[model samples]
Target: MRNANVMTASSEGALCSATRRIMLISPMPNRVRNLLAALTDHCFDVFSLHEWDDGMLDSLKPQLVIYDALPIASQPDAYNRWREQELQKASSRMNIPLLLLMPEEERQSLENKASVHVMRWPSEPEAALLEIKRIAERAQDVYDSRRAGESIVFKDLTIDPGKMIVTRGPEQIGLTKTEYDLLLHFITSDGSVQTREALLDIVWGQQFYAGSNVVDVHIKSLRKKLQDNAVSPRYIATVRGAGYRLADQ
Candidate 1:
């Protein structure tokens, strides 16, 4: 007989292998047992904590954080305020979504925020699981759309295609048209080595002489502007026999 604890392919079809990481924060462990089990059954990798740790979010990197605030709702107003503030701080820094589970009566007490979703507590396990899945799926969609329109980040370097800007840490790096095109090509190549001939066609086009060393000249200028050391590069790296590729790190 298949163990009930084991997730089968049919059972995992909804969430599948691409399960989202969920951080569940609850003071009342007894009350959350059923919800935790349900989440596990649905293929969510849950990290449960009795209390909030400021560093947990950064370390665990959960896509969604569910804070069971029902226990805190009955506490002194001051204690509730402190808890909310801590949750806000952690969620804002990581820009992850927060799902606050509270009593229906306490709904009006909390203000709505883009990153925060509130759901009534003491719900049936299946109902809570459905709501949690809905919130998580919506959050993932928003994140995907935002990332599609956002800057490309590699290590400490950020490339904003929309603004046509590149920055290494706090300093902005300027590049000429050819240099910018070359750097952008390397980034989009997904760290794959680009041969000189390939890069010439992509960035310089076929109009330029095939034997010209213009690629090397512009790459040097780009490296200097971005403060990348070819010998020990932080951004771009040369593959010797091959051509250039973005740094893996």
Candidate 2:
């Protein structure tokens, strides 16, 4: 029997021989428990809870989340409130990939936030595990790629793709991993006004809704770093409703 208590919060920092620390976020305790077993079979450290807890969350930073987006019609508004809070900070602290459980319509409606990956529940546990592992693996790949982009420089701004480090003139800009990837995408595109569709295709590959304000949100952060101005835009350039471009001047 595999001992579930031996796993850490992180999936061995990058890649583990185990399935890594996977948090199953479902309102139902039974579902959480069952999924925990599935994760266990894959050698993962699993955490389960009816609602988000500050202290527990503060300690274990999960690498991946299996978010069962079951409707909260009767589950109380508290669960909904709790989810909003957790989802808000999740992308910031850890770029954990989420598997949302909801109706196809609900999943389509959530087509806005790029922070979470929404998927209707799968029929087979094996297939579900496959999807879970695939997302987690891709997340690791993204993290690895950003490391090399850490030292990338764009005129006034200097970004170390390897370390997720960014420096603008004298001040530094702290960017999330997604933010960093978006910036790098513009840089590597050869000053092209990469459409949101292209950005979605290139950056996320096939994770979630790539066309969401995720691009806008990340660009907003990038603009702040480049000193939001009209003089020379510096790093990222606005192609106006089309997409964004990396400016030379």
Candidate 3:
């Protein structure tokens, strides 16, 4: 696999704080270059991948994936089928939304699916970028509105609130009710420090009085279950005199 070509909006001025991360997957070198050029002015961190790799996908943790499917669509039926099967498997394993670009003639072969947006290939760069922006915005909106009912994904961890289950990668890590609530609060804190007193009020309820060390004890247990190191945390981070916050990615 070719090394991913990264494009940032830093050339314009300061990087946009809300810049979205996009992974462009295409076997065609020219197409990848063209798309990267088109996105240069946008507030997006584009990672152009010449070939699809789930390992890279996990590592990148992009907000959206743009799969240029024209090459595969033009292949022999058997070859196309195999490639499509692999794509489906990779997509199924992640919560990131997909934007598929295919020829108009080949579009009919594909089915409509949730979180998968389709657009015709050979589109003008302007139109393609607009559609990509729209899909990314829509996906974010859906995630925000349905957060309580849907799975919350952060890096490699996934929390299914509906099921009250948390998984790191493919392995499920069991957590008690308090531990689960504490972790959920941390994820939703949006990197802000959560004071121990505030955490007690939110997770343990205002009426439940506890010693100063109660939050620390549960946090230690939660960190252990998440396999996070307090010294070098992947999920939670200490703030010295301040409370805790979700570690920066």
Give candidate 1 regions above 4 Å deviation.
1-16, 72-78, 111-115, 144-249
- Evaluate candidate 3 by giving its C-alpha RMSD to the native, one decimal: 16.8
The deviation in Å at residue 54 for candidate 3 is 0.9
Candidate 2 off by > 4 Å: 1-17, 76-78, 144-249
lDDT of 2 by residue, 26-85 (tens): 656555455566666667778776555545555776667667656567765776666666
Q: Candidate 1 — worst ten consecutive residues by lDDT sum? A: 1-10
- Note the Cα lDDT for every prediction shown: 0.70, 0.61, 0.73
| Window of ten residues with lowest summed lDDT in model 3 | 108-117
Clashes of each: 0, 11, 0
Candidate order (lDDT): 3, 1, 2
- Tens digits of lDDT, candidate 3, 111-141: 3322245678787888888888876775675
lDDT of 1 by residue, 1-249 (tens): 111132323354564656777888877776788888888888887888887876776787777888887755467687677776765454334446577787888754553322356777788889988878876775675466446867767778787876778888888887787888788666654354555765676677657676636778888899998888999998888777646777876
lDDT of 3: 0.73
Candidate number with the higher lDDT (2 or 3): 3
